[model samples]
Target chain A: MSKSAILRSSIAKKYWMALTGLFLCTFLIGHLIGNLQLIFIHGEEGRRAFNEYAYFMQHNIFIKVLSYVTYISILFHAIDGLMLAVQNKKARPQKYAYNNAGANSSTASRQMALLGSIVLIFIVTHMVNFWAKMHFEHIPLHTYEVTLPQQTNPEMVYYTHNHSLIPIQVDKVVVVRDETNLYLENTDLKLGEGYKDLHSVVMAFFGQSKNGFVTNSLALWATILYVISMAVMAFHLWHGFASAFQSLGLRHKRYTPIIAVTGKLFAIVVPFLFAIIPVLIFIGYVK
Target chain B: MASKTININLKIWRQKNANSKGSMETYKLDNVSTDSSFLEMLDQLNEQLVNERKEPIAFDHDCREGICGSCSLFINGEAHGPDRAVTTCQLHMRKFKDGETIYVEPWRAKAFPVIKDLVVDRSSFDRIQQAGGFVSVNTSGNTIDANAIPIGKAAADKAFEAATCIGCGACVASCVNASAMLFVSAKVSQLALLPQGKVEAQQRVLNMVKQMDEEGFGNCTNTGACAVECPKEISLENIARMNREYLKAMVSAE
Candidate 1:
C-alpha cells in the first residue's frame, strides 16, 4: 500500500490514537511529578523549589520543544477520536431497534468518547487556569521572607548592582525578606521581579484562610471540579492504557496480563495522587 | 428431552430490496415446538404465509447449522437473539415464553445493505478476504513435506483459534461503529502466525487492511462487542495480533 493509503486507513488512524495516547500518558507522569513538589515541599523552601522548577521548564529549550509536541499530540488525539466517532456513527446510520451493547463491552470502553471529552475540557480549563496565566497574562510576583547572614560593620562591600548576592560578615545573622531574582536579570528585589509564582497561585487557588473559610468559593468549586476531572482522567486511562498496546499490536499472551495490570495500576495511582493535591490544600494540610 | 409447544408474536423486518423502503411485518405463530430452532420457527411462519397466498417472508439460511455464517438476525436488541454465544440458527424457541413478543431485524450497517427481509449482502467481507486472505504456494508437483515443519503447540493453537472465524457479519452488526476490524483481524492473524504464511504476511496485512478501509467500515475503538456477539467465540486477541502484524508490515515497508 502507498504511504498515504496506510495513513488514511482505519488501522492507521488507530495507530495514531495509540501513539498519541501513550505519549499523553508520559506527559501525565512528568506533570504529576512536577505537581508533587507542591505537596511534598513546604514553606519558603518548597515555594522556591517549585518556582525555580517552573521557571526552568518555561525557559528550557528542550522543555519548550516537548511542550509543543505535547500540544500537537493532544490536538491530534482529540481530532482523530472525534473523526473516528463521527465515521462510526455514519457506518451505522440506521440505529438498532434494540441494543444491549453493555452486555458485551465495558462501560468505560463504550463511553471512551465521553470520558475523553471530559478530560479534554479539564485540560483546557487547566491550561487556561495555570499555563495561560503563567505565559500570557501579567501575574503578580510572590514575596517571602528569609533569614540571611549580614555584615555588622563591614570594611568593604563588594556586590552586584541588583545585590542578589550580597557579601556579608560571618558573625551576624539577620532576618530579612529574601527577594532575590533567581530567573531573570536586572530585577529589583523590593519590587518583586521575575516570572509569576505559579506555586503560590496553586496554593492560593486551593488554600483556605486561617478561619477555616475558603478564600474563594470559585476556587473551592474549581478544586471540586479538578478532583472530578481527575476521576474522569482515571477512567479514561483505565481503558486507554491497555487499549493503546492493543492498538499498537503489542499483544502477547504471557505479557499482556502483566501490561494490563500495570496499566490499571498507573491509571488509578496517577489520578489519585493528582486529585489529592487539591484536597490536601483545601483542608489546610499542605498550606 | 421432552418438549412443549408455544404461540408467540414476532415483529420481523421486511424490505423488498436495497433501494426499497423497509418496515416491520407482524405475524402470530402458534404451536412452535420448544425444541425447534429459531430459524425453524421462522420457517413455520413462512409456511403459514405461503398457504395464505401471500409472499413468504424472505430470509437467508443454507446449512441451517451455525457454521455456514449465512444466517444473521438482530433479535430483541442483540445480534443472534438474547442467547449468548449462539447464532440465530442455534437459538431455540424454548428461550422465549409463550406470549412473548420478539423483535427480529436485519443487521443495520451501511456496508451490509439489506437484500430482502433478513438477508444482507455480506460481499464486503468476501472482498476483504479476497484482497489477501491466502498465501501463495507453488502448487506445481513440488509439494513440501507437511511434517517437516515443526510448529510450536501454542502458535498452532492460537492460529487454529483465529481460523475458526466463519466470516459472519455479527462483528460488524454488533459493533456500534459497524467496524469490520474483528473480521479482518481474524483473517490476518490466522495467516500471520504460521511459518508457511509469514513469507507474504507483510503484503497480506497491508492489502487486507486497505481493502477493509475501502469497504467504508468504521474504525475500531475496541468496544469489544464484536468478539462477544461472535457465534464462533472468536477472541479479541486476534484483532490485537493483526494490529501487531500491520505495524510490523508498515515499518518493514518503510
Candidate 2:
C-alpha cells in the first residue's frame, strides 16, 4: 500500500487511535502513582516526599523525554478522534426517522467522543492550574528552620558547607535556620523547602479557609470540577481501555474476558483514587 | 390455523429514482391478516394499487426465507421491522397492533442511494466482496481431501458463526454512523479463522478493508447496532477478530 493509503485510511486511523490511547493509559498509571503520594504520605514528610518526586520528574532527563512523548500522544489521540467523528457524521448524510442506538451498544461506547471532549477540557484546565504555574510562573518558595548536634572540628564544618552534605556533619550535626533547600533542610523539624512547594499549592487549592473567602470558594469549586472530571474520565476509560486492545487486534476468546475485567477494574480504581484525593483534602482527611 | 385480520395505516417513502426527491405517502389498508408477513402486507397493498390502476411501490426481496439477504427495509425506525432477530419477510403482522401507524423507508446511507421507493443500490457491498472475499484454491484433478486439515472445534464454531452473515446491509442501516464494520468483519473473520483461507489472509484483510473504506462507509466505534439488527445474529466479536487480523497483516505486509 502507498504511504497515503496507510496513513489516511480508516483502518490506519484506528491503529493510531489504539496506539496513542494505550500510551495515554500508561501515562495515567505513572501519574496516578506519583499523585497518590500526596494522600499516602502524612504531614511534612509527605509534603517533602511529594515535592522531591515532583522536582525529580520535572528535572529528570529520561522523564522529560517521556513527558514530550505524552504530550504528542494526547494531541494525536484528540485530533484523530475529532477527524473520525466528523467523517462518521458525514457517512450518514440522512438521519434516521427514529434511532434507538442504546438498545444495541453501551452508553459509554456510544458517548466516547463526548466523554473524550470533556476529558480534553479537564486536561487543559488541570494543566493551567498546576503545570503552567510550575513551568512558567515564578511561585513562592517555602522556608523553615532546623537544628543539628554539636560538631568536632573546623575542617569538618568547612567540609559540610563545601560538600553541601544533607546531614551537615555526621558526628556534630549543624542546624540550618530558614533553609529553602530540601536536601539541606532538617527532616526532623518538618521544614518546608523553597522548590515551588506544589504540595502546599495542592493543599491550599483543596483545603478550606487558609486563603480568604474568594479563594475558599474557588478551591471548593475547583474540587467539585476535579471530581466531576474524574467521573468523565471513568466513562471514557470504560470503553477506551478495552477498545484500545481490540483496535490493536489483541482479541482472544480465552483471554479477552480477563482483559475486559482487568480494564474495567483499572478504569474504576484509578479514577476513583484520583477523585478521592481532592475530596479527602477538602474534608481535612489528608491534612 | 385461521387468524383474524385488522386494518393498518402506513406512511411509506416514495421516490421515483436516485435523483428524485422523496416523501412519505400515507395509505390505509383493510383486512391485513395477523398471520401475514410484513412484506406480504405490502404485497396486498401493491395488489390494491394495481387494481386501482396506480403505480405500485417498488421494494427489493429475494428468497423470502431471509437467507438471500436481498430484503432491505426500515420499518417503524428499525431495520427489518421492530421484531428482533428476523428480517422484514419473517416479521409477522401479529407484532403490530391493529390500526397502528407503520413507517417504512429505505436503508439510509451515503453509499446506498435509493434506486426506487424502498429499493436501494447495494452494489457497494458487492464491490467490497469483490475486493477479496474469496480464497485462491486449485481446481486441478489432484484434489486434497475436504477434511484433510484439522481445525479445533472452537475455531470451527466461530468461523461458522462469522460465515452466517448474509450481506443484507441491515448492519449499515441500523448503525447511526452507517458503518459496515460488522459485514466486513464477518467476512474477514470467517476466512482468517479457517486454515484453507489463512494462506492469503494478510492480502485479503488489507484489500477488503481498503475497499470498505473506499466505499465511503463510516468507521466503527463499536456502537454494536449492526450485530443487534442483523438477521443472522452476527456477533460483534467478529469485528474484534477482524481488527486483530488487519493489524497483524499490516505489520507483516511488504
Candidate 3:
C-alpha cells in the first residue's frame, strides 16, 4: 500500500533524481577524461588514442551496458526533472507581488529548470552532431600517407582497425564508395577493412583537418555553442553536485563542507577542460 | 535612543476577504517612534485609519514576542522583515531608514492562502500535524518515568533543536518554490529522535510527508533560503534527516 505512495511522492522522485544525478556526474568525469586525450596527446598518436578509445567504448560489452545505463539516466533525469519543475511551479499558483528571491537563494539554484532544459537541447544537438554520425553514417576510414625512399611520392597506406601491424597498399585494394570496405581491385573478392576515421570527423568539426583547411561556418558557431553549453553545464553542476548528496541524505557535519568545496571545484574544472578542447582545436593550437 | 521618531511610507496589502482581490495601498505615517516594534507601528497605522473612519488594515499578530507563529509578514521582500533570525513582531523600526518605503504583505504559498491582508491560512500545517506528527503513547496512569528511557545527549539536543520550529511558514514564504520541507522535516525529526516516537517512526514520516504533499507545498531544492529566513534558525540538516528517515522506511518496507 505504502510502496506506491512512496514512489508517487515528490521526495521519492528526488531520491531517483539524486541517484541518477550522481551517476551522471560520474559519467561526466569519465567522458571528460576520454575527451582530454584529444589535447593531451598530439599528432597521429593522439588521433589513434581517441579513436581507439571510441572503438573500445563501442565494442566492449561492459561499456555497452554502461552506455545503455547512460541513455536511461539521461532520459529519466530529464523527464523526472521536468515533472518536478511542473509540479513545483504549480505549488505557487499565484505569483508574489514583490519577491526578492536573490536575497535568499542562488540564481543558478533558482533557474535549474531553465538551465537543465538548455543542457537538454545541447545534448540533443550534440548527440546528433557526433553520436548520430558515428553510430549511423558511413564515415571515412583512417588513412595514413607513408613515404619510401624508392618512391618520389608518398604512397597511401591503410592500417587495420584492430591496431594490427599490417598495412594495405592503395593499389592492392579497391576502395568502396561512401563505405569503409576494401575490395580486391577488379574482383569480387575482398581484402580486410579500415578503421572508421572518427578522428578526422572530430578534427574537422572545428574547421581544421588532417589534410588541410576546410571552411566549415558551423565550426565557429559550434565551438561557441559548445563552450556556452559547457558553461551552462558548469552552472548546473555548481548547485547540483552537492545538492545530490543532500538529497540522498549523505550529508555529514564533518564531510559536507569538503563535499561542497569539491562539488564547486568539480563543477568549474571539468567543464573548463571540456570547453578548452574545442577552443584549442578551433584556434589550431591542438591541431 | 532617546525618544527617537522617524517618518516613513508604507505599501501594505489590503483585501476585504478570501474571495476579494488584494491590492497594496500606500500610507504615510509621520513621526513614528523608532523604538516601536514593527507590529506596534502597524497599530499606529490602524489607529490613524480608525480616526479617519477607514477600515483598519487587517493583519495577524499574537503574543507579540515572536514565538506564537501568528505574526506572519513579508517586509521589503523578506519574510519576517529584513532583519535576520527574528519574526515580524520582533522587527523594530530602527532597522529602517527614515524616508525609505517599506513593503508589507502576507506569507505567500499555495497551501497558505491569505485570509485577509497579512493573515494566511496556515491550517495546512495543522492538518499535516494531524496526519502523523504525534507519538502513539498510552497516557494512562502508569506512564514511564522520563529517565527510564536512556537517550544520548546528542540525540536529545538535536531533537530539542528540531522541536524549536514554531511553524511560522517563513520557510515557505522565503523559499523560491514555496516548499514546506523545513517545517515538515522539523516535525518529523523531533519525534523520530525520541524513543517513544520511534515506535511509529516509519509510519510517522510516511504519513507526514504524504500529508505534506497533499497540502500542495513545493519540493525543497536545498537553496538554504528556508533556514536563513526561519525565525528559529532551523538547520537544513533536519530536512536531510527527514529525507534519510523517509528513505529508510520505504526501503525497509515489505
Candidate 4:
C-alpha cells in the first residue's frame, strides 16, 4: 500500500468520487422503491403490508450487508469529494480577477458542497424521524391509516383586479382528514410497522406543541425544510450522477448520452415524487 | 498582412534560479508587427535587452510550430495566450491591442518546478509516462497486421484524439486540481483501445495511474478546465477511460 498521500492524483480522486457516487445512486433507487410502497395500499392492511416489506428489508442478511456497503459509500463519497475539492483548490493556487464564464453550468452544480451539506442536514433529521424510528426506536407497531381524499372547494370572495374578462377565484382550499381507523391482527408489532405509522409519528411531533397554532406552524416549517432539502438534493444528483459515471470512465459515446439522460430523469423525477409525498401528507391528502 | 507596429508593456517574470526570489519586470517594446508571432516579439525584446547590456529575458522555445509544445506562457489571464487550440509559440502578436499590458509567467505546479524564468522542469511528465504509460511490447514489429485489427470509428477517433496529447504541462497549469488526468488518460486510452496493447492494458493503466498519484499532482475534479486549456482540446473523456481501465484492473486483480 502506498503509505504516503503525496502521490495521489486528481484522476484517482475522480475515480473515488465516481465509484462511491454511483453506488449511492443505486442505493437511492432502492430507497425510493422501498418508500414508494407507502403509497400502495391503505388503511390497517396497507400499514401491515408496508411494515412486512420494511421488516424483510431490515432483517434480510443480504440486505444487511448491502446496508453496510451503503453506509460506507456515503462516508466515502463525502470524504472523497472533500479531498478532490481541496486538491482542486491547491491546483489553481490563484483566483481569476473577473469571472464572466457562466454559460452551460448552473450555480447548483458549481456549489455542490453547499448543496450536499444542506442535504446532509436534512438526511440526519430524516433519519431521526423515519429511519431511526424504523430501526432503533422502539415504537408501537400498531398500524395507523392516514387519509386525505381529493377535495376542492370554491369560496366566493371579491378580487382586487382592475376589470378583466377572466373570472379568477379569490380563494380555494383543499381539505384533508387524518383518521387512525384501521388495525392489523395476528401480526407481530415490529419495526416495519413503525414505518407504516410514519404519518402519525410525524404528525405526533407537530401534535406535541401545546398550542394548536404552534403545532400547525411547526408542521408547516417542517414541510418547508423537507421541500427545500429535497430540491437541493435533486440539483446535487442532477449534476453528480452523470458526472460520476463520466469520472468513473464509462464513456461509450452512445451510452454516455443515455446515461446522462437517465441520470437527469432520476434526479428530477424521483425527487419530484418524494416532494409529492410530503405535500400530500402535509395537506392531509394522504391518510 | 500589413507590418503595423505596436508598443506594449510586458510584465515578464524573472528569477535567476529556483532559490532566488522571482518578480515581474516590466519592459516596453515598439515597432512590433501585427502579423509577428508572439515568439518573434520575444526575440525583438531579447535583442533590445542584449543591446542595453541587460541579460536577455530568459524563456523556453523549440519548434515555433505549435506541435512540439515547447513554448508555454500565461499571456494576460489566459494560458498559451488568447488564441484557442494553440500553444504560446503559435500565438500571434495580432491577438493583442496596441499599448496593452501583457502578463507572462511560467507554468506553476509543485510537480513542475521552475528550471529558470519561463521554463520549468517538465520531466515529471516524462517520469509519469515512464511509470507505465506504454504497453509492455517488445519491438519485434512482426506481431500484427494493421488490416487484421478492427476498431469502431468512434473508439478509433477517440483513441487518436487522446494520442494527440503532446505531453504539454498546460493541463497541469490550467487545472485547479493540478490534475494530469487528461494527460494520463490520453496515454492509458491510446493503448487500451488497440488489440496489440490489450495484453498489457491492465498493468499499464494501474501503474500509470499509481505513478500519477505518486507525482503529487492534484486529482481531476472534472471541472473541464484541463480540456479547455489543452492545445489539442483533449477531452475529459480520457480521464473517463482511465477510470474504466482502473476499475477493470481492480476486478481482474481480484
Which candidate has the top score in DockQ? 1
Residue-level error in angstroms, candidate 1, position A69: 2.1
Writing each residue's lDDT as its tens digit, candidate 2 over B1-254 gives: 78989899999999999899898899999999999999999999999999999999999988999899989999888899888899999999999999999999999999898999999999999998889999887889887885999999998999999998989899999887788999999999898889989998999999999999888998887667888899899988888888878877777888
Model 3, residue B98: C-alpha shift (Å): 0.9
What DockQ does model 2 achieve?
0.63
Cα lDDT tens digits for candidate 3, A44-100: 888877887887888899999999999999999999898888888988877777888
TM-score of 3: 0.92
Quality class of the docking in candidate 2, CAPRI style: medium
What DockQ values do the models have? 0.71, 0.63, 0.67, 0.36
- What lDDT tens digits, residue by residue, belong to model 3 across residues B1-254? 39789999999999888989989999999988989999999999999999999999888888999889888999999899888999999999999989989999888888998888878899999999999999876678877787899999999999999999999999999988889999999999999999988989898888899999999999888888899899999999999999999899878844
On a 0 to 100 scale, what is the lDDT of residue A242 in model 2?
A: 88
Give TM per candidate: 0.88, 0.88, 0.92, 0.72
Tens digit per residue, CA lDDT, model 1, B181-230: 99998898888889988988999999999888888888898888998899
True contacts kept of each: 0.78, 0.63, 0.63, 0.44
Clashing pairs in 1: A98-B77, A249-B244
On the 0 to 100 scale, the lDDT of residue A73 in model 2 is 94
Error of 3 at B3 (Å): 3.3
- Model 4 C-alpha lDDT per residue in residues B1-254, reported as the tens digit of each score: 55788999998888788777677789999989978899899999999999999998778888888888788777775668777799988888889999998888887777777777777778878988898777654568766556577888977887889889888778877765566778888888987887767888888877787877667777665656677778898887778778888767755743
**Candidate that would win on lDDT:** 3
Question: Considering TM-score, where higher is better, how would the candidates rank from best to worst?
Answer: 3, 1, 2, 4
Angstrom error at residue A228, model 2: 2.3
